[model samples]
Target: MLAKVLLLCCACAAALAAPGVYDAVGYAAPAYAAPAYAHAIAAPAVAHYAAPAYAAPVVKAVAAPVVHAEPIDPNPAYSFSYGVSDPHTGDQKDAAETLQNGVVHGSYSLVEPDGHLRRVTYTADKINGFNAVVERTGAAHGAAVAVAPVAKVVAPAPVAVAAPVARYTLPVAGHPWG
Candidate 1:
């Protein structure tokens, strides 16, 4: 095995030192110079082909016909109201909005986390970007108190005792062959 490994290493070193490979460091000299020819060999002449002259077809963009679309009503009037009340969790919220004459007026109310009711009235228009009035009604009860859970104690069931079992062994006798 050792001899084989040494031979492989030697072969690899010879291959790496060959000419034209790893010559950037100028360590290995070229193996041999290229042979010179008596006369220079000329390349065969190939006929040149010129692409046929082509002019892109003239394309004129005709102006699309002017179309006048029906204008929409900018000052539309609309009203909507929505509310949600969950008695189990005591969550309540409602909102109402109305848009008239390019003006939006809306109001929303919700139960706050502190048990207080918060209401906001807002109005928006071109002159006044947005105006809102917030009002908090009812006293703040604060966070709800958490009650510790109680563990119930259960009595263990009675276990019935099993009767004792009896075992008997017969005396060994001499074998008939013996």
Candidate 2:
């Protein structure tokens, strides 16, 4: 048993020492050649480092700007509509809606490869009240509402409850025995 324990200790020490010795040898040499050892070090010394002759700077010709007489709208109404049509179940659903001001608003929907419908809605705040409802038959449903500002709510403080105390009682004998 003593010999076996010594053998195990030696095995663990060898395993721990192997990685340290291996890393020291693996990283000992540098990959790049030193500047003093390079043969091209003397080549640059023979060539003189001098600037070339100066030339006159050339000026680029500018073109005249063209102006249009027609006026264009800065904020154009962007309206788009899309829908998702499932190929497996043959169920079509609306996915997204986009609206810019009162002039334009649209919806879009798309069906994923796994028979899932994805919907999106985009609407401008120019309208008074806007509500969007997205429903997936059996998977998930969501709703969004835009309402006028309402009163703020404050929660009441919680009431504290007293903890119960454990009581112990000793039994009394009816008659004393000698």
Candidate 3:
């Protein structure tokens, strides 16, 4: 706490100075007896501290350098195709694919809500793994028409009228709230 208020203000300025106060060893603390000139005054050589010399820091060891990375392409080649004819939900479809060195050809088609046209075709590698083959063409045209999703008209936010303050009403002759 502020060193006890600076040691109570140096003990109230050494008790308002002067009462034979040469303390800390220069002994003249009288205020009573032994004031015989306090032994001719001469006691100031007590300094014994000694603690300031530094040097302890050294470390070294390094060895790190070995990197080799550049080899990727495990039969990686690609090709892609996509299609989507969504006449508001009539939702047609289409797809295509290809990978080279590892075989993976593909095909896709849709539109089969009694509207036929469902072609599919596929293939994979590692010596024949997957293979698809579905084909439906035309032939049922009489029940696919339910489109209805196009309505977004939001226009109604323009209103800020506040400009009419004319004044001229001096025809008073019996007004109650004219």
Against the true structure, whose TM-score is highest? 1
**Model 1, span 1-178: residue lDDT tens:** 9999999999999988765455444444434444567887654443333344579999999999999999988768999999999999888999999999989999999997778899999999999899999999998686676669989989899899998988898889999999
Tell me model 2's lDDT, rounded to 2 decimals. Answer: 0.56
* Top lDDT hit: 1
lDDT accuracy of residue 46 in candidate 3? 46
Q: Between 2 and 3, whose TM-score is larger?
A: 3
2 versus 3: better lDDT goes to: 3
CA displacement after TM-score superposition, residue 61 of candidate 1 (Å): 22
Q: Across residues 53-102, which tens digit of lDDT does each residue of candidate 3 receive?
A: 46778777777888889899877999999999988988899899999999
Count of clashes in candidate 1: 0
Model 2 per-residue lDDT at 118: 58
lDDT of each candidate versus the true structure: 0.83, 0.56, 0.79
Model 1 error, position 81 (Å)? 0.9
Q: Count the backbone clashes (under 3 Å) in each candidate.
A: 0, 15, 0
Model 3 stretches astray by more than 4 angstroms: 1-42, 46-51, 55-67, 74-98, 102-104, 112-114, 118-136, 141-178
TM-score of 1: 0.40
lDDT of 3 at 147: 81
